[model samples]
Target: SVNSIRRTSPTGGTSGLCFKKLNITTSSYRIIINRLDRKVTVNYRPARLPFSRHSLYVEDTGSMYLIHTPGGVSMQWYHSTGIMVLQYITRYNASVPTRGLCGCCDGNPEDDLKLPNGTVVREVGDMMLFLQAWRVHTTDETEHTRRVGDNCTTGDCSTCLSMLRQRAFTPCHSKVPPEQFCDIMWAGDLHYKDHQCDFLAAYVAVCYTHQVCISWRRHNFCPLRCPPGKEYQPCVSTCTSRTCLNREYYEETTCSFIREECVCRSGTILHRADSPYCVTEDRCVCTDNEGNPRAPGEVWNGSARSCCLYKCMENGSVVAVEPDCNSVPTPLCEREGEYVLDVLEEGACCPKKICECNMTICDSEAPPCDNGNRLVIGYSALSCCPEYRCECDPMACPPVSAPDCREDQFLVEVRGQKSCCYSYL
Candidate 1:
């Protein structure tokens, strides 16, 4: 039988030797046979047909071995690659139906089809997919046992040597330097003091988780702690201390946030005298220095009697003159005394002579005064006193002839001539 062929060396002139064969019954085998002509033949048999064509090569240079089974099964392994071994099959039914070797374990195939040494191998058409999903497990079953579970350990596994040999993976701590820890802590403390302490606590917790180390240079956790020279006062509207800022220490005080003060300007008097400060009505009454009451037209001065007088006109004239002396006075003399006496003596008095008694007097002693008349006192007048001559008569008379004069006839002589006078006695 091809399985029972004894180990025999080929007979040839060059240093030939005979070898005995041992019986080994395994489903798969690899044999090397030598012939007399110094020819060497190697044969391989797989327990199940159609094994993966890919194989793992353990040479210095990295290479992948491929095994292709007749039934479309495939297996792959790497020599010095982090992944130690891998086995897979294309058909669901086949020889040792196990997953590929675990990278977290030695070279043993995983018992469960689903999980292989914590590595998951999936079967594809005529191929198997290998990935690093395995974890190491050490238990009593095999002191260094490999299991397929979620919480498998990779501590002492040879296949996990790569992971163990490399340094641990940590986040970038250089960006947030150690020197900035004080500042970060101070800010957090201030925030906590002013706002919610929980927020600051959460922030500190996150920083610690990220490996940020904080130092305690100050006595208190907050930056605003009472120092040697300074005292801790609750933060009021005016917070001057630096430590209080760190701890976010604050004190509430009464604040006139919405209240405002009202004041009057200089030279202004407050209308409301009772209230000294101006609130609602801030009126200012302008006044002079004197306390006297000022009239509408009057201006008050600094002195008590110092008042300005205003002049007003009445009927377009000044009001300074007395009212009784406004008109002219009567003359002193009663009547025209001497002037009237002088006028009566002179005949220059008209037809009516001025009487000594202030009345006009007629001259009756002379013949009744006629149009033409001359007067002789005693002799010239025969019939009637002086003016009895016809020619001297004041009235014009006709000449008396002898026959007409016999009734009353008289003769009179006057001025060296005889004259006839006629009288109607």
Candidate 2:
């Protein structure tokens, strides 16, 4: 849905969008459209700016490509027509089938209206009731909602019938009915020619994939204006770069989809997908790792494990050197007498954020030994400081001897002291 689907702002128009699948809101994203300049902004997930097809690991936010497995799903959004295309790039598997707004994608349309609890709506009259289940309840404030018997008529689009039924579209008439497409374009936005053209272009693109080319645009109606040196084509590759970041060359035969786009003319090329202007091969620009176009004298070192910081040179090449630990800044820690060093990864030359103890910090001073007892110093896991204990030492005892032993009789000790012996019996 294009408006707020969150509970806090049902009609507040705050959140960008919410996609619900089987009674579950997949993700919440906000889209801000600038009325003054007709620009669009997406906040928070995937990307804020325009981007080409990329792996969607987060599965959160607006029209985007998503793939859990290899070639699972591909989504494309044409902002001009407000059309979003979700396709299954992966081969259909009997073990894993999708069931939702797209229907049970198992080659059957009968079970397409199955509810979240696995109940199918079998009655034709209940189709409206089934559709109401997926209603998000967002309406354009600029227009009035038409009731069943209201005299709400969209302008006269009777003139579009002949064009839709033209001989050029005969091959695609059965697959895509002309009356349906014509009426939808009129009902959607009758006054806006671009909207009508955008609406028609969708059907034309579908026909092109079926090996039919549509020449529906008129010279004065929705005529496409391309950049200088570029021409509009009925069919082009879907693997084209949308942003100025990626600069890889692709084989035209390996395109995933054949659609319409503006292509550069001969002798001119785009440095990256998002380049606004066409230039000669030598005049192409360069981009950094973050998808930002960079000029000469800029530096980039966005790679995590790389130990070198690169500088963009005038020749369009980034120069780098394998810097040692001296190039990287050392971290400052609290207190004195502590040191810091890098605990690098197995094959990485860069430093990690781990800290190790270089010196032991003891707490209290040890007391003097007394009574032939010695103080023992030991370490324990509970603390980094040394622990003190008192224990008896045999060598630390006072010297003991008898004064004299009389004849055969041994000397008898007075009291507990051995040195107190005076006379023996």
Cα lDDT of model 2 by residue, 224-333, tens digit = 55657566655554544432233344433324445555566667655543334555554445556655456677665656765446666777786775535566666664
* lDDT score for candidate 2 against the true structure: 0.50
Count steric clashes of candidate 2: 5
> Candidate 1, which segments miss by more than 4 Å at Cα?
1-28, 31-62, 70-72, 85-143, 146-425
By lDDT, the best candidate is: 2
What does the lDDT read for residue 122 in candidate 2?
A: 92
Model 2 vs. true fold: TM = 0.46
Angstrom error at residue 82, model 1: 7.0
lDDT of 1 by residue, 1-425 (tens): 01121222122112111121211112343422211111122243312221222331111111122333432333332111112122334343343333333122223444233444343444432122232233323221111111222121322222222221222211212533322432333332332222322223233333333444332122333222221222222212221111111223333323211111122333332222111222211112222233222222332223234323222232222122222322323333222221122231222112222313211231224444343444555432112222233245524444443433454785543322232345332
